[model samples]
Target: MTEHTDDTDDTIEGHERELSAVREEHDDADDDVSLSLPGLSVDRRDFMKAGAAVGAATASAGCLDALSGGGSADQETASGGAKNHKVAPGELDDYYAFLSGGHSGEIRVMGVPSMRELLRIPVFTPEPASGYGYDDRTSEMLEEEGGGYSWGDTHHPRVSQTDNDYDGRWAFVNDKANGRMARIDLEYFETDAIVDIPNQQGTHGACCLLPDTKYVFGVGEFRVPMQNDGRDLDDPEAYTSTIAAINPETMNVEWEVEVDGNMDNGDGGKDGRWFFTTGYNSEHATTESGMTKADRDWVKAFDVPAIEAAVENGDYEEINGVPVVDGTRESSLNQSDRPIVRYVPTPKSPHGVSVTPDGDYAIASGKLDPTCTVIDVEKLAEADDPADAIVGRPRVGMGPLHTAYDGRGHAYTTLFIDSQVAKWDIEAAVEAEAGSEDPIVEKIDVHYNPGHLIASESYTADPEGDYLISLNKLSKDRFLNVGPLKPENDQLIYIGDDEEGMQLVKDKPSYAEPHDASIVSADKIEPADVYDPSDYDAEFVAEGDESIERIDDSTVHVKTYVKRNEYAFPEIRVQEGDEVRITASNVEETSDITHGMAIPEYDVDLALAPQDTREVTFTADEPGVYWVYCSYFCSALHLEMRSRLIVEPSE
Candidate 1:
């Protein structure tokens, strides 16, 4: 995926389905046959193999099967009338992928088995159709330092969990360019809150939540010279590469501590009683550089001190004061002055690290090295006296950037430079003899430069690792050239037991640059439908505001309600040159049934969550009819969820 800027037009808003080009590129598999054959349970590779034997007619029949990332449901066609009710849409793909929309500052929701784009949640960016930055309710959220920033370069998205498992309540994403994090309520599929990380200038590798979502960790990618200027990067203690741990409930930085090395970015952390981070670039130089052993690559751990523990110790007076918050309530919590943290060396350029499902080990990938390292989770947790915490290092392949675990004790590492993913037994490696050769169990070749490999993976106490999604950075010859910059490729790989093998199942194209993604089961989230006027709590509006009214002849106040596939509110009829104030309320409670209001050509778009009311003001300068419709794809009637604003000439 590529980095899009705030100035990008509305063209990037649509969910991608690069079907025609994918067909053109893989024409050799395009056989012509009757697609109405019996037994619709054919898998992805079965479609291709069947085409090879049954002629071109069969290839053309299952073309959509290839486009949809391969599964039993794909054969259903648009009418969705295929007799196979076993693996239909909303059945097999009970999991949803929340991916970073890169510089677009949006989060794309994709169904797992089908890879279908569900909804686009606007956060740090100004979406004209959703009226995110254009509307006052969300306008203030995008402001950087002071004033405001237009777009975001979003990087990591972490789903909140309970007891270290995906509970499906909310998802948190970070804006690398802006040093901020935002929360998305999964049930409503709407952005609920955003807060800035303190002491961090550049937010990168923010694998925020640990087990049970106790905290979201963040560190500066490029540490600014805090005390030393033009000096050696050797001063790891003085380096400004500080990692901030935020309280998920209050959105407060409960603790901040300087990492023990000079690093470019602290990739991500694995949670348990002890939290850990993997990173690169300690003792780095711009032009003059000599890499030391400790500076080469490293994995670190931080012990999250509870509020009770802080009080028990009675003011570690030398500690810095805790951070303050700015939201619905104004409260301050004390930041732990001295948090217990430790680290050990690893292969060069360790980027992504994760804890295994059974809480047995922590796995990290080295981007500059061929193999990956698996450290004992038990040893890491009990390392109070020891300085080094490494358990075993297994060589997998070239440039292993990240690792994903399947609940059945297998860890899959993505090899970026090698264009492959190395799967191995995590427990075996963790228990292997030191200095012994540990080889990977399986290596599946992928497209060029696979960045992140996501399974039904979560940073919760319990992990679900059934399937994998390879977010490949390049789509080189996979599709027709849109221009110079190519489309991204994401493939579905099944990690189930029994008959199905560990192979590529489905492949599809993602238009924008998607950096990282996280998945959650559909059952965990509860969305809303239909918002009523009585439940609205309006803090952003004038004192004692009513549902609907005419303030004066020049200005009118209108209240509107929205829900699934329809709107139950009145249309505004105002005179030309009159000031208009519209408050739109989304009355919804069903999971993921949010609504949007977009007045195209008028530069007005608003995102309304269930029982949420937001106001937007614009002048009815000319006499014309403006159409308002839902910007985000909610369901079958998204396009039909519309209303009209008729502007009459002053008479």
Candidate 2:
């Protein structure tokens, strides 16, 4: 109802251009006529205009129901839908879904069945609430890459796997914007390490898919020179990308395999013997037209153990301080004695590659086509011709992007153009001839443009077919009008074992955006509610013996302890222009009795969980008394928990 801003205007213009192109492609079909409403009549074109007016958001739910003619049926079946799967107040959910916070530079943990956001774990960005990036320990971790990077485009999140099932020991997320990968300690629910991936630009997809997470793997989505030190700027043919295998325990890049073209999202086999990724830019094109000119791209399969063996045998070249293996076709077909990579041709511009739960097949979605190519995982290494590896090409729907298995011989594919999810039988698809018999079992209309959808434990060896979360790209009129920008929608669909068809259960407003997520059963993860002081160094704990150690003329170290409503160091005095180091230890032994400290004028905040210790360093530049108080609620006397830092003027 309000005038569009400049950004909104640009967005509308872009959408208009896109719709115009769609109209031209369809020869300007006049099938979208006016619809008969209950009292008022609205044309389909006018309804689309309303969507465009709201910053080209997704269409209203009522509009989708009217178009699909299944609204009343959905309401009538509500009793048999997700109502049975609801988690009442004071009850716990059955699963933990870790969602990648796209562009927000974080990971969100949501409880399944309830769809409630339990916690937000900041990975690639600073979180002020938890004092993650501000604390001394986390700040040092962020400064590892020497760029002072603040934000990252997080894409895919994978929970560590053991024997192809959720291990729940660690969660890995990739920073697509900064070419970095982070590891979150599941027990502490905190980011423990961040490894800067060398010889890559955009780390779009990474996962700890092997058993016990032997090595975390990732691929560069963009191609660049091998060294990428200001060379081959104009030559597109000279550009290449890589897939890096990192040591999960050490959090270091052990080896990288150079590929010919840019790789997209990837998944590994259950045996940990092979990994597969979708490929594009195979023509080495610089322009969009040239990039999509080819009729088919590839689904590349890499021999994981073979590549590692090659690296072990001193057959890799060092680039950017990393051992780089030549996996490109130019190097493999001509120079290498044995092939370490196989490029199986698939439909144009594949986007997502997923391994089936049984580990027999790997499905690659065809983004530009209406099909998904299924390749045999074992045949990838033995097939003389790459074409022999592919077993099926099922025509799913318009703009199929990602596939999630139900562990019941069925696969659900997200249709971007159709705004729907199609369920198909995998074996039926493989047996039937292409375009002869429809392998699609059912199709459920999502809100709009669902980019990625994940079934409960879809990527693991044991997938539960209880529910599926559709990561819809837009929520347009789903909620109250916010502004020019609206939050994305994460729709919960009930695809339970006994259900006849998929039922739309609830629409949750997701933060900013989320690309992909992994749902693990609740029993798989057990995090610590209380911190253990013995795990940290003894020097970090104060043990109620508060003291100030003057290391040098301009340096001072103050050690303090905190309890329910008191501080060991009630007051600390320092001289102006002095470098001060303060160490605070929460001596509380109770679980969930966390403590925090904050200085009034200083940019310092510490989140001290029970029995947790933290340190902060700052320069005492102001010649005034600064009050430090507890930032986390502890007890009834929480407000009285305060200490004073007095800074005297330097002579």
Candidate 3:
């Protein structure tokens, strides 16, 4: 009984073997056993052995013994309860989370803490529910470049910022399926502009410049020919990608800087000086097998000021009516020229690159390796070699994809293969020895594989460490079995204090897939409850403008007004082949009162809030009386509100 052996291994592989033994001892034990840890509920031995074995085993033997006994929390479930973070009925949420609908082609506004979906703003797609693409005003915006796109794959949603903090005036999102970007006005909660990016394909990463949001930058994820005029189809070496800078005010492409490799994700500096994006395919691989051959990829950094200055000095070439600058390593290193782009080498196939809240360090996640590479941005600009800028390579876990901040010197990174979130200390990681486990504080298992995670205001200068959302890709048995397809699970975790750990408070089911989201405080955004006709074009009328004008022999412009239970123009007469343009204005000044206009046989629908005006244009080809009714429930007499459009036969 007194046999003592000091054979316990301190190395990672040694601890890994010890962890295997612990796992075998608990083979037949209940895996759902609650632990004394703040939010852990799995079997004590299994929890330490499975997702976070190596990091846990690095601790002293005495600490491991205490963890196995299950220390203190008397009453809690495996997924953590929501008693403390519950949002009562009729209560307002503390923050607003703008989520990008991956393939849904829209932006979903959700209330934080409550996980309630507030609105779905259609950006690059047509929505029959809100008449987004059906209305003439939005139709013009969609057909601006003459592309009839019905769907889009939105990736990232970035809010406009001032002084490195959210200003809440506009939100920018990218369409991965189509090379385009959209701007959503926060006040009206509507999309105002959509721009097709020139000379860039597969536009993936999008972010507004910090400190003032001077420009919105988007990076192309797929490499293609610079001319793209049916040339260099088989030459992988000739293909390259470019990062374009868009003028936020005009929503136009200002200039583009060509770079090496294919970019994936990006983040901007707090001072609006640098923009960095991850390159997952640095090998310039045409096939999937060739992509993983390289031991290291890169995070390409773009000098924004230098690019802008080059454009002003006309030190660039022209392609498709846009200025293009050569920023490749070969051209940048020639004769010691001022480089506009620098490629900082990182571990294999990096996925997401995010800057720290303080804007000091750029953390790039290693997708193929079990670590994250942290680079010093200031040093990166002047480094003679790309590898010299790297400060630390913290061993987090398997398949680290993205990182979020707590503003308390901590970083929470999502491990895709491990299906867990690893919380690490930033300063400790940079100062500790390589491969040391001191940086990793704790890790908790999510429901399934999570691709992206976001904390409250994590990307800004002042990150509030209150909550985090895990955008998991699978929800196997979390809810009732619903046919073959299931909704994605978005787990909400309370990440308030250092000692609280990550408590899984709720499991919110999101439709299809949601890639990324930006969380901001509620006080920063002030949405308008109603619209003002005075702030719109003169063609919109709130009073005394209900008349029909014959624009030409076959075109008519019908100006109509609406209120409670009535339409100003009860009947409109037009010829069979006449082109009809109808503008419906709601004159009600109440906060919640809204009106809808719909024509039965025609694909026409419009939603008008109080004091709002919208237009619909269509050809009256069918010679019949179409009943127009209110599609939205506004009042008790909603059923009685109707109008008739009589299309007479041609003489």
Residue 587 of model 3, lDDT score: 87
The regions of model 2 sitting more than 4 angstroms off are 1-72, 76-83, 145-147, 333-337, 538-543
Residue 596 Cα positional deviation in candidate 3, in Å, after optimal superposition: 1.0
True-vs-predicted CA distance for residue 41, candidate 3, Å: 24
Which is the leading candidate under TM-score? 2
- Model 2 lDDT per residue over 1-651, tens place: 443234533443454345334323423223211110011111233223343444233222212322234432334353334358678999999999999999988899999989999999998888877888887778878886524687888889899988888888999999899899999999988888898899988998887646567888878888998678888888888899998998888888999998877899899888878888999878889787677666567888888878878888888899978999888887743244447888888766799989999989999987666678888877776678777877777777666799998899999998776667888889887786653226777777665678999999998988998889999886665667788678888988777843457766667898777899999999999998887676665355657587899999999998888888888878899999999998888888788888888995988898888878888899999999999999998899999999999999997
**lDDT (Cα, 0-100) at 638 in candidate 3:** 98
Which residue runs does candidate 1 get wrong by more than 4 Å? 1-92, 144-147, 208-210, 226-238, 262-272, 287-295, 306-339, 381-387, 433-439, 498-501, 531-536, 539-556, 560-580, 586-602, 607-612, 618-651
RMSD of 3: 9.0
TM-score of candidate 3 to 2 decimals: 0.89
Per-residue lDDT of candidate 3, residues 1-651 (tens digit)? 111212211222343344334323433433221110011112223333442333222211111112124332223532344346767899999999999998989999999989999999999988877788888878888887515677788989999998888999999999888888899999988888898888888899888888788988888888998889999998988888888888889999999988888889999988888999999777788886677666557888888888888789887889999999888777743225557787787765789999999999999987765678888888877787767777777778766899999999999998765667888999898886555557888776665568999999999999998899989876554556586777888978777756656666677888887899999999999999888677677366656878988899899999999998999888999999999999888889898887889995988888888888888889999998999999889999999999999999997
* TM-score for candidate 2, residues paired by index: 0.90
The estimated TM-scores of all candidates read 0.71, 0.90, 0.89
- Output the better candidate (1/2) by lDDT: 2
Comparing 1 with 2 on TM-score, the higher-scoring candidate is 2
- In candidate 2, what residue range of length 10 has the lowest lDDT sum? 33-42
